[model samples]
Target: MANVQVGNGVHRKHAKNQRSPEESVTEHESTSMGSDYELNGSTNTEVQTDKYGFIGGAQQTPGEIDDVPPDVLRQREVKWLEMLNSWDKWMAKKHKKVKLRCQKGIPPSLRGRAWLYLSGGKVKKEQNQGKFQELDNQPGDPKWLEVIEKDLHRQFPFHEMFVARGGHGQQDLFRVLKAYTLHRPEEGYCQAQAPIAAVLLMHMPAEDAFWGLVQICEKYLPGYYSAGLEAIQLDGEILFALLKRVSPMAHRHLKKYKIDPILYMTEWFMCAFSRTLPWASVLRVWDMFFCEGVKIIFRVGLVLLKCMLGSPEKLKACQGLYETMEHLRSVEPRYMQEAFLVQEVIDLPLSERDIEKEHLSQLRRWKEARGELHCKSPPRMHGAKAIMAAEPPSRQDLQQNPTIIVEASQGHDSNIENGKRAKKSKTEKNKDPNSSGLLNPYPLATDQSQGLLKEGTLQGSNQSLSSAEHDTYL
Candidate 1:
């Protein structure tokens, strides 16, 4: 047997004290847990492994097994495979069904592929074919690379993949984070991203993981991993405000103790609960998070507070800030079980509309208290489905439509054909007062043009504004 250090600093001996001849020859084969364990000589010790490959006593923690019936899992896998094959149609016509399925759970076998599809990582990879390779080929900035190297061992260290120092798991994690720094030098790297990227690597390959991290940092949660983390701070305020309605008792307790939401929630929200929730619940929450967006995160937080501190009896142990923080950090296992947490998140009344309304209110309050925000990038489209919905018409679709207007942003002269100005005939120009030598047959009335522009209908052919932008067009 060989001693192996698993995640969280626990050490376990190999399963068998002596390897058979066949076992020795096939030792390098990948396991169902998605990692290859290397043997280091032999000893007489033995230990058991969990379904997820956590060894020894670490298996006592929750989420160690697949609780779903084999038949149910098979059926869900079939449905998910069908949805993935006709993803565009499902997203366009049967989104509710997709949401319902994601809420129930994504099959373990299909989770990696599903996450790539749901995060629009697949689409992003398609758009920028060789971008990750380009970034990977270059040596990353020393500032970020140095910090990233230090944090690599700390991410899921007990997991089989990352257990060995400089192992493939840590190596892939390094590539993803280092590539990100080169991709967006200004933002650099955030320590919080390491664990998030580690979770992605567990499911997908390194290239897919890089794009998934890109979608997460840039699209799913804009401005979140920035230098000051101003966006997450703003979201903390929004979460607290929403807590008042979800659990007034919990709100009162925090307010009475003067406990800032950021103190407890920074890790939870920043890592999307990867460090806080059990392994199974984290996957379930992430399935919904990548499908629906950050609202799922908010709901999970609100549910935790409501379950842990919503009542006077529950709050008895949480008499002060220290106790409250301690309780939050070491949450009782019962409160974090996948079935319970998923149902609570699903039943919660929180919606994206509610989050946005509170976001605006918080923004106004922040400006009043501390002037303008540093990061003004507009909010991103929520979820993988929203990203897919906002995708511009495909090149083939554009090529088929000859009369479509050329967007000015694409370095095209909107009014020119070939190398010359496309002038309208004098008779036609005089017949339609609103005509501007474009393809629009139903030209807007003089008074309607400004309103139409304000409404965003006049932006451009290729522009794909988010639903929020459409709702708040000005």
Candidate 2:
């Protein structure tokens, strides 16, 4: 076998004898998984799959088992159905309830639909009808199309959907990624986007998955997949700054070892932890991420650091950068359990304002260290809630007027405008329901509003590492 270098230092081995691309890909898939599998079990199946369609075998250690009873799931499904039916009402007037439901976890049956709603992908699809099909039909840039082809089978090989080399899963994955490159030709394609699109395809059809990918690349995370990857690099600095407050010990250990945040966090943040976390935990995090925004991602990273490197004993084994990097790559199962990680994320005292504050600090630092940053785009609206609240102008509006001006009300602060804080006038402080463009969904609980925003305080009465067991990653 001959090894061929792929992106991100990953290598794929080819047979000694030359073969066509399709032949090599088919050979690769067949040899990699021993045999092909399908979504529904076949008579000749070699392994049993779990509820989520991942192949289960003696080699794979079970991470977290879903303990929620069926009846409970059914009841939650009913509630979710109600919320979905009245999604606008829930988002408008009962946002707290929506947030609470999302934190609890969206029912598995409704996860795909709820994600479409929460990501604002459904709205984007409705607004731009038949756009994905148009892009899919067009011949994409040959450069990106080839790259996307090579990466198709690399995503979720263990899952039945992507096990076959030229299966529907791989086909849909190619379409979504190729369409994205066509949609945003300037950005082209990035390897990290393959897993994200693959995960979306697992839940929804190709068209919906494409829109979800669009929402993620354009709205939830801007400039993340662009040339030079300047946005993700900037966010890496922001994550390091946040670690100073979230877990000082972990932050200091990394500083002492001179481990750059980008070294370990690139996969974690860019793929939204789809590659790093357990399958169940990945879905749970995405549920919150689509609802909230990048804050869920930041919180997850902080939680992992706090669990793995917060203590001296845990840091002792990680004496050097290689050990630390290995430890991060192979996360301990206990730390990534779905229920535990979700709760830690909910309790963590990290907020959007904290991220914004650190973002500004990091930008200044970057400018001082390395002159002007090219391809640095302005930050987009944070999450689904913020996106819906802002009600961004339609594509038609943008097409008609290339530059849309936003008029700031007198004496009112516009954080999105200049990233500077301003004092509100007396009348502005009176809390008018309609003043801020966002309707006041519910009366803010004094403590709930201000509690998690406090520095150096992890709320919810549950400490990050409550158990005494010290488990190390293999």
Candidate 3:
């Protein structure tokens, strides 16, 4: 019942494509078809809920019945679907001529329709291979060819690189991506396209890769590549916060050691963890991402942190920054894949509810921490800031603060007789000073004065007190 979210739904696109933002948010509601109550006073078996409205079918996961009548909701939903279908046709026809960028990793099957739906291509041809291919083959439009040729090898040149390098999977990747760049000039070449392009080469045909790539760029990547960076940074921050929350001890140790998890995870986000996570697991994360939008990313980040926290010895072995990154990256994409699935994972003694409890535990500790920040520092001790702000004489403290002071030795036969005289004179002066404190001539303790009448001599060893007491003066 409490529906709330912070990040905006609308994703911005490259300027040449759709001139506005595409909605990124998706709301989960009950299904819609119709109600059990019969409209004509007959026994109606239909059951509809608002959440299942999108599928235009009943909820796959049924729940306790609500108070609303299903038949009425179903009737309204039917009308709504018809209205949207008509609107989609109008919009598709309107933007049919507009060019855009290709997406990554042959867009998910569910995603093709979503992209076409969002682009208004649902009705006509936001994703028409036959027509677009004709447009490409037939050399009437000088502009389209000119743009495609210009970017033939500009951005994700997987195929071009293959033609140049002749290695593993480059040829197929290059072909599909280049084909897409040609078709969609507005979204011609973004940086993140490569990994996505690479992934697309796996499942979809080259042309499907091209169209799926289009959907991904338009709906998923969020704006241009630069805009993609912002999304990456935002996700990185959220992940860092989650890490600190889920593994406070590890986070504190990292901080104490001047280690930053973001340096490791930021690359994960910027690259879609393509290089880090196994080939399959990355797809799973993407599956959740496209379906649930960015919230799933936050959830995925928490899961990753939880994964790392599962073993400290394994984590500790990762010494350097890159070492830590490499280890996590090596989480055997298969094992990680297994980590999230299965009844054990669900019953793994943890859930989102447990995560919330962990988060609250952190919050409670944070509130109860040393929140009291007093300006008062070590009393009577010199601080750098104070030394800088004080008079010129105190400036010496700045340089002296970092210097090591050697303890001077004391006690000797010759100095002992002089010390007695000096003590007697000081005691007499102290009594008189009590009567006239202002006139007390406090002798300046000159550091350069070697009381033994020489510097660095064994003669002063007798004056040296026990080693235990020697450190007291310092």
Candidate 4:
């Protein structure tokens, strides 16, 4: 049975009996055994044992983790030390190798720091040292407080840290989320932000977690958690396009029932697969996701679709969207293993170039359809349900109503925006700003130019993806 650690107390139910005192957890390793890190504010190191003498808690027992041969452990330790000692060099010049290293997995002891580096959180934390506290000290928007409060315990209820109603985990979750609301009032607080914050808190301290969340929301997945969720909708369409090519049988079967990707994929994309994949797999996905870009997500999604309903027989069984969702969510744990699923993701033929090309193609269609936004009932694509509840405007809307797009694009702070665009040449200023790579299609609700708003938006297409069998030519 799983052992439940309730703060300072260890509650053992169905697990094995306690170990011999000689074999009891050591003072140094007890707290850090599970999750590769101690839960914030947890001080008790005594691990309770079940009837079978097995240790239990939110994580695997020490013996289970120690099952790895000492030689392998030592080798990993050496690699971890090498990574820590030469972090800057790895990040700057040898990032491709760093990606390969991450694919193997980051040492639990070093995962926090590695994630910080991967997400650029270390620099972000330094730049915004007191910002979180400043935001915390101020009163939060009344509108979002209740939502945050309601969603606190929902984050990681089974985990010891967040199990209690007013525990440190939930408190930190609130502070991090609330600070984000204060930091970016326009986006306010979205329910999806809670899980991401909760996952960050699980691995790092509150302040560090806060900055990581900031990097994720503002930098990693721009426009993702905003009120409209335009990015999710756009990506849903992109996924549909990819599905048609990757798994035509599954794609067509779903379309036969008019089952849309949005119905099942919204939460998957919104939470970065945090809620969809198991904890172990989720961490592995994060390891790669931070190293690469959102391409990891698309690839993972493809693998999931292929696994869930790639065959005609399986797809035929799903009578409707609801059934399709159930089948998708019910994928076996064995197949979703971190190593196996990640290897499949790596082997996937999909590429960022594919997603970028699809995104541009879809954006052009959306741009053509902007005049229909006021129709109050946006036309569904091929009779599929709308992924974005708030329909995005067409490109014509940007040309005709430039001010709306300009104002909507201003939600982010100027410094944050500068970080996104970097430097421009004097000669570049003479050219049309709209024609610049800076403008891209965002969603209609954002009323902002979304086509090329960020540096990462179009750059993914240029990167080379190595296929499992061969290098892809894009």
Candidate 5:
């Protein structure tokens, strides 16, 4: 059984014997806990044997099993429950306090709900009820199905949630991935998305998990999991640039070895440290990431680099990318603890502004180097649904939809060929703005169109058409 040691902490098996770095690397390599750690341990009765004859579980309550002390766990539960109740007030008025609380750590008991709120999963889940089931009922793309199935057992195989081939955990994981395939057909399924969605499932229901996966893909880390993973490649350059400023010697040493940031940071950033950090650290990092955005990830990466290979001697000791990667993968449990790592990440001077500045600069450099077009940044996903609902559609979109703006165009005497004027009745004039065709130009209005979006039924519809053409757009 492989065990992790950190900061002179006791060596303990990770639920089941955790796989070593070598095993993970050789195995096509992949990749939690109860409420405390969002772990899903099985009772002894349910433990199943894999082909290798590895068994998982203990006699105690499966969800209650955790490494955190009982008092600490209780305290966190109480604190988080209070915050969860006043979530809206705190988020809107006491945001700094919220960030502080998140930096401390979200209580495991409330982590699922907290994450749902932080990632705006509730709105999305509500907007897409039954969609996951619809997608699941259909046979998925065979290529993605094969890849997802192969990676299922590879991720958190020791945990009860995903230990068996067809357990609820694995089943939920499948539904979430399938829903994402349905959600963003352009990107389809990426190997990296599985670990992320699996972690979300450990805390929330499958429906919530699906939305959280959507939030992560579209909001938190856009382009990171896309077809070419272009954002990830760009961030690799960004990470190296940041590394040079924070730890020049280590940066130079890695450069000397021709060890690219992709060799290490791909799994680190794409998996959001799920594959690199201990389970506890992964949870803590996620708590901050959900609250603080992607900057937390960069800060955590910097801190890990500084801790493991900050010293010239240590950097010199690593002969190649494999050694550097093994060193990172084998982080000591002591330093990897939530209390320790979270504080270090917080103390680091890395800021959102810094990350944004660096990202723009790096993106420009990348575009110039590759002669690629500079596409507009992805739409801001922070409270996106609510924001879209509150705001009116752009004039351009209103013009595009001839049905909604027919009278407006006539009043303006605009040269819109094939457009006809339609008069509104008193009842139409008194109708709500959303129902008066004003909001229909953009499909974000609350209506059946969002449901069509949820089920991916409108995949073939022309986006330029008016809201009347579809029930709504998301």
Candidate 6:
């Protein structure tokens, strides 16, 4: 009877401790280390401990970022440089072939940097950024910047207006030229830069183009637009003289008609013939120009006149003698470049020698033509009694290296123009001459010139490319 009573008490205790199966499962999920559940009634992916230490519904990602090696990146760069250099050799060889046909060479896509490097300019852009940060450290930057800033739009107003209107190449040219003028003040401002600047900006970034302009001015086309404008005038006279030699009849016709090639061609030499050709052909000429020098310009100009004027039949039908020039100007795009490239006419290697000789003769002629004026290191002039007498400066007098001054009171004291050229008409010659502004033969603008002259504070072509390309062969 005692044993039965104890067993009944134990059975009652076990029943009290037991839970329903669903409640047991819920409690185990909510509290157990190996499982999870939501007490707040929101569904979510649960975190739980497992043999792996921690597990979640989220998937694991593969591998660390350090797995790739850096040597591979360096190797790829070296390979690319090799390929570019090999192609460079290919271009050089084709350009150098003596009897090679003149064809429209493809404009280098690397034109902007090429222009700079070829011209002897540095183009590392990071250099510009660091240079900018060090601007305060550079003492003369302010004045140079001011001078360049003033000419920015003045040098390129048409471009400025074009860019503001969202035309493609114009803006790039403006920025590059402007930045470069800012970068190098020794070449502060000059004519003939506009079109070349435009061309460079078309192919490369503006800053790179800026350095290119520098290279051309500094290295390639030396003394072209320096203070005296002597280089441009000298080249022009040389071309004119060469034209007369090449085609006497045409030169006579031009002379008889009082046709000034200088008027039409000034635009050409000033910008290195860039204005006359499609951008690519001009660049091809530039490629040769880089390899050669000023002589290429003369050679090219000689050949151009030979083609345009070689035949009386071709030239005689024009209404005026000047009409031939107009025709050359108006030649269809296809024929113009081909006319320039033809080998039978241009004969590059043979012509290159002649051009060099011609260049020497031209220099001698200039020395004879202008006497002491062609000398780059001009003798100093002091306004002494001899200078006041208005006698030509003696070479011996200059050898002593005395500082020289001509009568600044007379505006043409530089002798670039004779005092006679500056001599006012009889009525005004004796009157106050100093009052007259110094006569600049090539004043920056003219009435016939575009009348826009605003101060500058700021700162190329393309497609229609293929038709322009094939035209060089004709």
RMSD (Cα, Å) for all candidates, in order, is: 17.8, 18.4, 35.3, 19.1, 17.9, 35.2
What lDDT, from 0 to 1, does candidate 5 have? 0.62
Estimate, for each residue in 256-340, the C-alpha lDDT of model 1 and write its tens digit.
Answer: 9999998988999889998888777888999999999999999999999999999989999988899998988888888898889
On the 0 to 100 scale, the lDDT of residue 110 in model 4 is: 53
Task: Look at candidate 2 and tell me the lDDT of residue 166.
Answer: 61
The candidate with the higher lDDT, 4 or 6, is 4
Name every residue pair that clashes in candidate 1: 1-43, 6-158, 7-158
- Write the residue-wise lDDT of candidate 6 on 345-364 in tens digits: 34644344454466578778
**Candidate 3's TM-score:** 0.38
**What TM-score would you give candidate 6 relative to the actual structure?**
0.49
Each prediction's TM-score versus the true structure: 0.74, 0.74, 0.38, 0.66, 0.66, 0.49
- Misplaced by over 4 Å in model 1 are 1-47, 56-66, 392-474
Model 1 Cα shift for residue 339 (angstroms): 0.8
Tens-digit lDDT track for model 4 on 220-327?
Answer: 576777655666777788898888898888788778778777888888887989877756677778888877767788888888888788886776668787788778
Model with the higher lDDT, candidate 4 or 5? 5
Model 2 Cα shift for residue 387 (angstroms): 0.9
lDDT of 3 by residue, 1-474 (tens): 222121112121122221111111122211111110121132444323222111111111123324236454333333322322343232335322111111111122222333323322222233242754543332223443343333323322222111122122333444455555566655455555666655554433344455555545544444424433433443354455556666675565456556555565665554455445533345555543433233344555555655664466756776666676566665544345523432222233333344345445544554477342222111110111121122222212111110113332343234656777868755876664233322212221343224312433213222211112110010
Q: For model 1, where is the 10-residue window of minimal lDDT?
A: 465-474
Residues 96-130, candidate 5: write the lDDT tens digits: 87778787777655677777777776656555557
Please report the TM-score between candidate 5 and the true structure. 0.66
lDDT by candidate, in order shown: 0.72, 0.72, 0.37, 0.60, 0.62, 0.42
- For lDDT, the strongest prediction is 1
Q: So what's the TM-score on candidate 4?
A: 0.66
Ranking by lDDT: 1, 2, 5, 4, 6, 3
